[model samples]
Structures are given as C-alpha cells and as structure tokens.
Target: MKNLIDYKDDIYKCSRCGLCQTVCPVYKATLNECAVSRGKFNLLNGVIKGDLILNKNLKKYLELCTGCNACKDFCPSRIDVRDIFIAAKAEYYKTNKLSFKEKVLNSYFLFKLVLIVSRFFLPLYRFFRVNKLIKYFENSIKKMGTAAKWLILLNSAAGNGYKPKIRSGSSLKKVLYFDGCFNKYINNETLNSVKKILAQCNVELVTKNFECCGVSYLNDGNIDEFKKIIEKNLSKLDDDFDCIITDCASCYDVLKKYKDYSSDPKAVSLSDNIKMAWDLMKNLEFEALKSYKISVHKPCHDSYEFIDLVKKIKSCEYIEVKDYDKCCGFAGKFALINQNISGKISEQKAQNYIDSDVDIILTTCPACLLGLEQGFAELKLSQNRQKPEIMSLYQFLSSVCKISD
Candidate 1:
C-alpha cells in the first residue's frame, strides 16, 4: 500500500479547479469548500510541505468525503482523489492511536455482529409481525433522532420473491459467486435472485468462503487490515473457475482491484475473470409480474452499464430520475459519521425520485439500498406522498419479475 507521501504529485496537480465542487455531495450539502477535493488537496499539499501537522482536526476534514469518486470522474487533472484520501487517512492511523469510538466505528467485526444479530432475530421479527409493527411506529421513531432514519433499511430484509420456474441445468459455466457481506450476513435474497436468474441462463455457481471485501478498511486507510483480508481472499481464489461473479456493485469494484493490492498470480487471474452477474444475464429476458413504474440508483462502485439491462425489462416502465447516477450519500461509514451531511444530500436525491413518482427504486449495492431508504425515511414524507419501495436490483427483479426467457 502506498503512503500519503507517494501521492504528493497527485496532490499538487489539483490546479485549484473548483470543478470538483460541482459534483461533490458533501460540498453540495455543507457548501464547505474544505469539504471538496480542491480544499482537501490544499490541506494535503501543506502536510507534504511540512507546514501543517496531521491531527484529528485536519483528519476530520478528510473524512468529509463520501469516496463517491464523483470529483475524480469530473476532474480535469484526472487525479485519483479516492486513493489520495485513503493514503492520507492511512497516514493518520500510523501516528494517532485509535480511540474506542473510532475502533467501534471502524470495526468490521462489530459491523458484521449487528447483521448477525439481525439475521438471528429475523424469524422472530417476522413471526411476531414486528416488521409491520415497526412500520406502524416508524413516524414516532423518526422523531427521536436522525439515526432513526434507518428504520426502512433495517426492515428491508423480508419481502416476496418469484418462484423459480426452471431448475439448474447441467453446468455450462464454472461461475464462482462472491456474495457480499450484506448478502452473506443479513440475508441472501439478492444472491438468491442472482442465482435464480443465472440458472435460467444455465450457469452453475461455485461457492467458497470469502471475507468482507475490505472496502471499509481501505476507505478508513486501514491498509494493513485491508491487505490482510485481500491476501486471505487471494488465497482461496480458484484459478480453475471460468469466472468469479458478484451481484453487489461495491464488491465487484473491490474484487476487480485485488491485483492492485497483491502481486500474487491468483490476484491477477482473479481480476481477469471478475464479472458482474448482469454480464451473464444479457441474452436472457425477464418481465415484471405487474405493471409499475421503476427507477434505478446507480452505485458509485458500479462500472457496468446495467441500467440498460434495467430498462430492457418488459411491462415495467422505467423512469430516469434527474441525476440518477449521482451518489446516494450512503458511502458506508461516511453516512453515520456525517449524518447531517448525508441526510442533507440524501434528501435532495430522494426528492428527484419523488418528483418522478417511482413506485420502486432499485440499486445494485446493499449500502446504496440503505442510502435510498435513509433518504426516504428521513424525509418523513407526508401522508399524501407515497415513498417508493427501495431494494437491491437483483432482489427487485427476482421478487417482481419472471423468467420470460
């Protein structure tokens, strides 16, 4: 992993262009120039020159980012803002000792523990009709605090799915599946949906024990922890599989970059064969069970043009909301750490979807799904307005669409 000093050149190349401000969700919400890339580059540039020290105050400014890479994509200098910030954050971790709160916030163990608890209680949550009760008392919860905005996201695990019309055929493709931490821990609805669709295409899935993609660790600049998990994942990567597939955009993004972290030959081969499940579902056709208006929230980690696939669904009308490709502001821990900024950004993005009057809002990543739900929940929408249903794209498809192929 590279250090902050290594990105000195990239920091100096900022050119003080304010173009980044145009796309940064943080800047849009807070209007803090320091919250954007140009401002961050200036601070980093000072640190490189030894004019400023890396302290918690300076580090707080760096954490202002969503790691959405919106500015990176829009940059005229084409600097890698995401990696530079990570490198800088890694620098912070090197010198400063982590506080207990910081440890819990960054702890993937505790994060997964929350999901494990959720999964364990899901049966009781459903059997006692707790989900419905939560929905009934949702408005009361929202009044309690901003954190309560997660009510929709927390209750999202249970939903209806279409019955599989076809059985798995003789294995034609040796596709290894990478079910992300959210799917593996909370529920497998998204993975189940992908498998249902993949079976229609006659693709047999191979499974393996895999850890969290270490995206949070990477974003937190916990490079050592990130690489430890990366090395472990690279160890289990089978070279014989025709391709490794993922339904989560964020996981796909991280898995595709495995070779960047490790030079192991398996890492290179794994990156070579990394594929989004949508690539395999191209020729297959699906139709919604009912006529409804649907829209999509493009995940920041997504590189695939799967929106074309979403638009191709028969019977369901697809509406393109304004700035549908913008970040949902749920950039993992960034949401909790910067709740006000996140809530502000999500509110505006949610309004766009509201204006379009979409019945269902689908995204490829679990975090994005939560982000959308957070946006809607925080709005505490009027009784007159209907909040669109939020779901992972695969879950939405498998639950509402049938294998027309």
Candidate 2:
C-alpha cells in the first residue's frame, strides 16, 4: 500500500478527458488546476514513474479531495480515485510521518480520551464558543506545520456540539443503537428523533460503548487503523439486543459490510429499520398527515435501498428531484478540508430541492443534512428568500404516526 509504483498501471488507464472535472466539487469551487482528478492523476502518475517525489504540493492536491466518490461515479473507466488517494496518503505518511495531532486522532485511545475530557467542560466550553476557539486552534496548528490540523478540527468541532439525552424506558423489543462517534457527539437531535420513532413501534433503545466505524480512516488508506477500530467496536458488544440501528449512512454502509473475526450479524441503517417498523405500525388507524410539497434527498450510499421505501410511504406525497443521488459534498471531512468545492456541490443539491418548491426536504444522513442546510441557506441568502426545512425520514414519521400499546 505504501508503494506509489504499484498503482502506476491502474492510474495509467485514466484518459484525462476531464469528465471528473465536471463532477468534482473542489475543482468547481477552487478552479485550481490541481484540485481536479485530472490534475491529481497527473501528479500521482509523475510520482509513480519516478519523475517526482511525494511532496507538499501532491499532498495539497490529495487533501483537496473530499473522497466523496463523485469523480469515480462519473469516470468512464471507473478508476477508484478515492481509494487511490487514500493509498497515496498511507504511502506519504509512511515516509513523512503523521503529525502529533494526526497520531492522536488516529489513536482510538486518545480520541476517546479527548471525548471524555471534553464532556467535563461541556457547559463552559459552550459558554465560550469553544468550537470556534477550536477552529482557531486548528488554523494555528496548520500554520505551525501540522498537516493533520484539519482532521483535529473536524474531531474537535464534532465534540463541541450538543448530545442527545438517551431516554430510559422498558419495552418489549430491545435495540442496540450503534451511535457512530459523530452522531453521539454532534447530531443528538437525530438520535432523539430516532429513539422517539422506535418507541412508537414498541422498541426499546440500548447501547454499549462502541468504537468509531472507521469509514473515515478507510478513506485515508490506513487499513491497519481501520481494521483495528473495527475490531475494537466488535469486542464492545455483548450481543444482548435484537437489532442494531445507525443514522449515519456512511456508518451504516461500513457496518453493513463489516467482516470482523467475530462475524456478527450485519447492522441495519436507521432508515431501513424505520421503514420496517413503519410497516408494522401502518395497520393502526391514524389521521392522515397533512399534504405538503416535500422532496426526499436520497444520499448516494443509501439511495438505492431507500428509493423503494420512498415510493411506498403513504404519509407524505413524494416529489422526485433529478440526480437525487448526487453527493451532497459532505462526505464527512470532505467539506471541511475542501470547503469551496463542497459548497458548490451542496448548493447544486440545494437548488434542486428549492427548484422543486418542496416545503420540507427529507434526508437520512447527518452529513447530507449539514450539506443541504448550508446549501439551502447560501441559496436563500443569495435570493433573499427563506430556506426549506430539513428533516429525517424517521423524524418526520415520528411526528405523524400514532402508537398503540
């Protein structure tokens, strides 16, 4: 994985036709020659053929990508650009070494340690806008010569946000909520809404401490770190709950494909579980949900599975938008590291929904929520109009459905 020469053949297949440029969010945002796949491909090819060594410029080009898979989606030859970049990072880190911040971020023990330490300062941290302070810290770290500052900032930013109060209750069916690190740290509203929806279906929510799903690290081509975290997560489960649910599409996508030594049953996404639960509750009579213009933003990871469910739901009339599976530009750290490109991709998705005139835009992933909201807000600001509300499928269903004990 550390050898750049190994990918020479794989990368040689790239035609450099610039199809990737058309779909690349960062390229669209920065307009820099190096931000697009074509530019990165040329750089990597040069390195592989011994014309150039892995350098800061190469890293910058690699880092510009969000690993969102859009270029791969549109590529004629279907080269794995994201995976290739991840491999490049692993190769680069092997020789240049990871910074202390990256080393800490890459270490599960340290990451969890920071989360524990941050919890104690939650009130005061919120009072002083600690997250904003963290942004400055990361900026300083990057300025002080740490390549991993962006990663630290993302971890710190995720830590600064609100957490959900996991409701305690006794119910018939017990569930293990695989609260991915970010959802637990930042987007607790999604967790609460999911819990409320599950409760309506007579399900009890429970969770044991779980490790990061390692999808982010996987994108970095750190297979050792990815496998280490995956194993750590598998060990924490005692197998008491019937079903496991996750709200993050990326986490769900990763965990569903998780092949640990233990071979635990695959985890289900919250949307899939919700659709199943909704089917069980559909027989119960309830007043019709009010009709309103609504659009469903199906994330690329979960869109195929969710599309059928979208078609089957009766509560809200579904309005379809073109290219609904386009990446929302928030593939975890993609937007943070490549803000300009991410913003453009996000704005495009937002415009799709706005043009449809949907009252509420429903999506499943938290990243999509942020990307869509940011896009909608920017578009709204541009037009001097209001942005549409964003809601999760589970959250929307929980608001409308009635539960019978």
| lDDT, candidates in the order shown | 0.83, 0.65
Q: Candidate 1 on 1-405: residue-level lDDT in tens?
A: 678998888888888869999999999999998899999999998999999998889999999999999999999999999989999999999989888988887776787788778667776677788778777777677777755666656776553322344474686776899876776766677778888778877787777867788888888888878888888887877678878888888888888778888878898888788888888887878799999899999999886388888999899999999989999898888987898899888888899999899998888888888788778777857877778888778777777888756
- Model 1 clashing-pair count: 0
Which whole-number lDDT from 0 to 100 does residue 388 have in model 2?
66
Question: In candidate 2, where is summed lDDT lowest over 10 consecutive residues?
Answer: 267-276
For the record, the alpha-carbon RMSD of candidate 2 to the native fold, in angstroms, is 6.9
For model 1 the local lDDT of residue 124 reads 69
- Our tally of clashes for model 2 stands at 1
Candidate 1 has a TM-score of 0.95
Question: The CA-based lDDT of model 2 is what?
Answer: 0.65
Which model scores highest in lDDT?
Answer: 1
Residues 1-405, model 2: lDDT tens digits? 335567777699999898898877778777887888889989988888789788655776788876667888899989878767878877877767676756765676776776666555554666777556755544334334223433443433343343334445667788777777755544455666667766655677676667778876776656677767766777776645455667767776667545521234432222133222233333333322776666788776664655555455556567888767777877765665666677677778888887777777777776677677556534534334455667766566556544333
